[model samples]
Target: MKANKETKRLFVGGLGQAISETDLQIQFSRFGEVSDVEIITRKDDQGNPQKIFAYINIKVAEEDLKKCMSVLNKTKWKGGTLQIQLAKESFLHRLAQEREEAKSKKEKSTTGNTNVSEKMGGIDFQMKAVPGTEVPGHKNWVVSKFGRVLPVLHLKNQHKRKISFVICFSE
Candidate 1:
């Protein structure tokens, strides 16, 4: 995605304590119109402020933004390798995206009998069953299917002809 269309804010890292907002604006204005520059700082243990990083809001063409990021990222400036990246989307945007994903997953889950895999946080949960098995509600077949992953299995909704379970795995 293009930086100009997605976002104009850029996260800048590895800035020195001596650098100022105007200095950052001067360095970034070579490629585009820098609308604003913010140098973030935090107090150290000794009660002295230290420069952590900065954010730059620039208006530029798509190609210019790409070139600017390439030229500035990892470049040595003020005795530190600069790390430049497109800042993350706002919290509202992330929440909206998550809600949309949940809606789609809910829709997919309401369909016919099939295997479904879901990832939440750092855990993997897979719901599956052997369709062509002769014996109904066989736990050995289910365990054998996921033996490679060393799963922690939880069986539920058992019946004469069908068995549903959840298999969890950690990476």
Candidate 2:
């Protein structure tokens, strides 16, 4: 027995790697206006990624999902079963997490907590960010994950190749 709140996003799991975001967006369009299709993946210890699952966001309210949930759930898609659930928690978590982070950041700023970049005057390179190339002359800085600051090279990303964004840093 689900509640009557109208949520636009839905969690779609039990996905196969073969499914593309466009494929999902097209398939889900039959129910309502598909806003975005996000496929969440998992990374191995070696840093290689593997597909885990996906999510579909519709433009209409939860009533749209309620109308189409039965038809899409457990349906065979790309030779795999698709599981769909309302993304009520997704919305709630996003709001709650933002509030929590803002509070934490405020506390850190008030206490004069200095970051690594402030002392070192350079950026921390994670496994995926830094490219094997010279730094660019333009751009001031690049923000890292978890709102960390880093002065970095200007990166060029290709938008035409596919839906995935690929940024290439060059000399």
Candidate 3:
């Protein structure tokens, strides 16, 4: 699959069971700034392993990504030929996107509740503050009100001179 412009995650296939995430990270680090690596595996009830692959996220230029894929793809390592390509959107991420879209459509259909609060990904909470309310230490306030804070977005209306905050909670 083609790489999304906003993401630099790569899918690496044909990995031997012996290869670890660190091994892949170290090898790919030479091409770019490796951010995350995960080696996928499935084991049977008897503890015998099956299905081996990996996903690696690297922050690199477009040219560097091409270089990396070209140089490493089909190379023999750890008794398997490496198959490197741009990673597709993860299953969890896709599910979240679909849920978010559904929620958005539902919201548009019904318009009664003034409260603007939503739960995203079953963990993160998005809370919108009432317009024209000033919150001091917004980040700290969110942390104290909620268990943990992920991101706080402040939206201001120029015409109305009103301010609002969209706080996303981690917990």
Task: State each model's C-alpha RMSD to the native.
Answer: 11.9, 14.9, 15.5
Candidate 2, 70-133: lDDT as tens digits: 7889988886788888765575567568657755765576335665543444443433354432
Most lDDT-accurate candidate: 3
The candidates, ranked best first by lDDT, are 3, 1, 2
TM-score of 2: 0.46
Candidate 3 residues lying further than 4 Å off, grouped into runs, are: 1-6, 44-46, 95-171
Residues 1-171, candidate 3: write the lDDT tens digits.
544433488999898878988899899988888889988887789877776889998888787788888999999999788999898878777757766885787568545533223333123333444333334334323432322333446566868675645565331
> Candidate 2, which ten residues in sequence have the lowest lDDT sum?
162-171
lDDT for 84 in candidate 3 is: 92
For model 1, where is the 10-residue window of minimal lDDT?
Answer: 118-127
Q: Please count the clashing residue pairs in each candidate, in the order shown.
A: 0, 0, 0
lDDT tens digits, residue span 68-122, model 1? 9899999989866799998865565665676578557766774463332322222
Q: Estimate each model's TM-score.
A: 0.48, 0.46, 0.52
